[model samples]
Target chain A: MEKIPVLKIGNLLLISIQTDIYDSQGLQLQDDIANLLQRHSFRGVILDISSLSIVDSFMGKIINNIASISLVMGAETVVSGMQPAVAITLVELGLEMPNVKTTLSLEKAIQFFNEKFNRETDQDGSSQE
Target chain B: MEVLKSKTLKISEEKDLLNIRGLIREYAGEIGLPEIYKVKLLTATSEIARNVLKYAVSGRMTIRILSDIYKGIEVICEDNGKGIADVDSAMKKGFSTSGSLGLGLPGAKSLVHVFHIDSKLSVGTRVRLIVWRK
Candidate 1:
């Protein structure tokens, strides 16, 4: 019954999945992210799966679903720090979660999001207030 | 098959799938299977285990170590649900009714050396996989 913690920083949400994810857990996370998006305004979500050693097609689908859901709600999702074996398995499994973007490291992910949001905020007619 | 060790696990819930993965990793590693093979076995088991949870809502998975003319590990997953109507089509990528990517059975079969699946209408499904030590 472990809950994956979601943290809010500025205009983004962060979730670090370090353990094996269950079906309920994955569903709960999708719901949590969606709920959080409603109560607050965010532009992006970053999922850190560096500590994860295994991932299957179901888990891959969940990630795909989350990214799509976030996209519909006006936020993009960025996944960082995937293990090599997992990447190989995901490719071999043929999961094409195109909406979910990937950055090799946390630092790069931060920079990527920072530049994206900063550009949004910089525009005079932007949605952000 | 000369058995070195074996254990049976239940895949009746969401959490059980994760535990089964951990158990498979431990047992497979204990048998000294290589890292890549370990990952393949783990991924293959995850696929079938998730299928059991999705299609049947519950099932049993047995892991056994074999040592005779061939040294390796074997995994069997059984479930009593609406049996796959057409395994040939089901095994094809992108063929799924449950909103999945339909990569479970096919992805699993490619990871191991020996694979077999048997099921009947309204009966159940039994998938067997064996990966020899190399």
Candidate 2:
């Protein structure tokens, strides 16, 4: 069996999940990713789901949970590279993850994060009550 | 009345993980399930199939389509393997006895209209799921 891979880039954590996203192994990967975010204090997480062929309601729930928990830990979560079919399946299953950002590509996701980070820093530098 | 039934799938070495999804789609379609319902059922069935192959060593699934005012598909997946010792806790979202993401049962339940599990420690585990067309 192939293992799901996780990588850290700057303050962003990228998790390359192997196996169908509906399976137990894939869900475990979600939990593991959440733990990593809490432990490392990453600023953001990018879940690269291009490899997944399927995403069921259960997997969606786990991903949603991860995104929510990450926010509590002060980390924003972004899901990128979702196959169109997987997105359709998730929508049909009524699986919606609130406050989770999505991007078409990793580069776009990184750019979005950079912009958000810069804006935050600028605001912090200028104290306006 | 016997509303719907399919030929028994032979348990064999030729069967791979992908085959399970195909079987599920065929049966689900036969039961008049919408395309969306078919996709969800396929995913849930695939998860259970993976469990069968990983833990049971070998097994087969029987799907029956129920007919009434409300049409639905019922899948009974049975395997002789190490039965789940703590089904209640296992049903929790993040609990996995195999250290897996533990989403198999929870995912399956979320996809179907009804979900039930029956198991004996040494005997086996039988998972039943019904997905109604909406």
Candidate 3:
């Protein structure tokens, strides 16, 4: 089975979906992300789907599941880079993935994670002091 | 209506789903559908195609380009499997027998300009989807 690569960078896993993934591939990605989060101490996941031109109900479901699983595994998940058309279709399809956080671009997602975790760490450090 | 071009493709495997989307995109471009409408058509086609794979195990799709009163694309998906029992309930949101989100049929219908479905208990199911150029 072909696997979508999950790259680790500074306490986060970055997955850039450069192609329209198959349904099984999406399921596999969810499993892979869960495994990575469980084994590694990753603080967040950034899923870049800007390259995906269409997001149907199944793909939307798979993404929602991934975000939920990542949350359970103690990692925040942000899906970024949705094309304008894709966003419109998602709404028309009524797949409001309320649980998943989204950003306009991968850069913003990374910044979001940095700020989030940094703030948490700051709080922890100050509490300790 | 005049038929410009027509093609048929088998939809059995997961890869076929991607193929169908690509084919729809190509045909929609050929017919001069707007990019956003193209995405809507592709997404709707995907939902129905995935249902065919999940329930019937396999199916076939026919893509036809039409001209005349409505310059549009029509897709007919047919599958020979245990058919849907209650289509009305099936169309309702958040209804699924296979533990899915049950959004495929309704979501697909919402995206396209025209939609139709037919099914029988011991026979099979067929769904017709169409999107027009605007």
Candidate 4:
């Protein structure tokens, strides 16, 4: 049973799925992310799925669930690095993951969270302390 | 149709889904399936293969590269468990009995160029998925 590794950087967690994970593994990942979010004060989660060759309806649902769970735990989720072919297939497959936010690459995903948190900090005006 | 290449795989567990995807990718590439169609076929294959494990508990899949007037790949998945009771309803979106999103059958059909399903209660189900190089 291989577990997908989750790395923490700053206040965000990065989960780069590098293998063609099976159904159980995807479920395991959802559970792991939930547990991590419960234990940490992370503000965002970045999921990189560039290595995944296919995103079927099952996988699509898993990803969506991850994003939803993260949101409930007070963390935003950004999925990045989807291959062009996968993009086309996903839409054609009728799995519009409206709940998940997506970015084109890791840089964009990181930048997205950076700007978002910065804006939040500025709005609250508590980071000056 | 002419059979360019063919292989058989068993779908008894979750890991077999991965193997089905891998084998489909290989044959799709070898047959020069365009990137978009290749991805479509692969995704459809995964959906159907996973269905076998989820519902049937065990099954067999056959991959074939066929050429008649055009080149294409075909996958046939057969399961021995109790077949789908109402395939028409099963093909509808958001009609899942297993608490899933219920997009497996309909979504798989939408991805490929050709899709066929045959099932009988108390017998089994056979789904045929095909994508052509165009």
TM-score of chain B of each: 0.95, 0.86, 0.96, 0.97
Best candidate (score: DockQ): 3
Candidate 1's C-alpha runs over 4 A off are A119-129, B68-70
Candidate 4 Cα outliers beyond 4 Å, as residue runs: A126-129
The candidate that achieves the highest lDDT relative to the unseen native structure: 4
lDDT of 1 at A49: 91
For candidate 2, lDDT tens digit of each residue in B1-134? 34566544533332455566666667766666776677667777766776777677777787777776777777788888888888898777667766666667776677778889998898998998888876
Model 1 TM-score on chain A: 0.92
Residue-level lDDT of model 4, residues A7-125, one tens digit each, is 99999999999878878888999999999999989989999998877888888999999999989999999999999999988887788877688999999999999999888888889
DockQ of each: 0.55, 0.16, 0.89, 0.84
Error of 1 at B114 (Å): 2.4
List, residue by residue over B65-132, the lDDT tens digit for candidate 1: 98867679899998888888999988888888887788999988877888899988799999999888
Give the Cα error of residue A106 in candidate 1, in Å: 1.7
What is model 2's DockQ versus the real complex? 0.16
The per-prediction tally of clashing pairs is 0, 2, 0, 0
Q: Can you rank all candidates by lDDT, best first?
A: 4, 3, 1, 2
lDDT of 1 by residue, A1-129 (tens): 777899999888999998887778888998999999888888899998988887788788889888998999999999999988788777777777799899998778889999987786688556555
**lDDT of residue A5 for candidate 3:** 96
Q: Is candidate 1 or 4 superior in DockQ? A: 4
Better of 2 and 4 by TM-score: 4
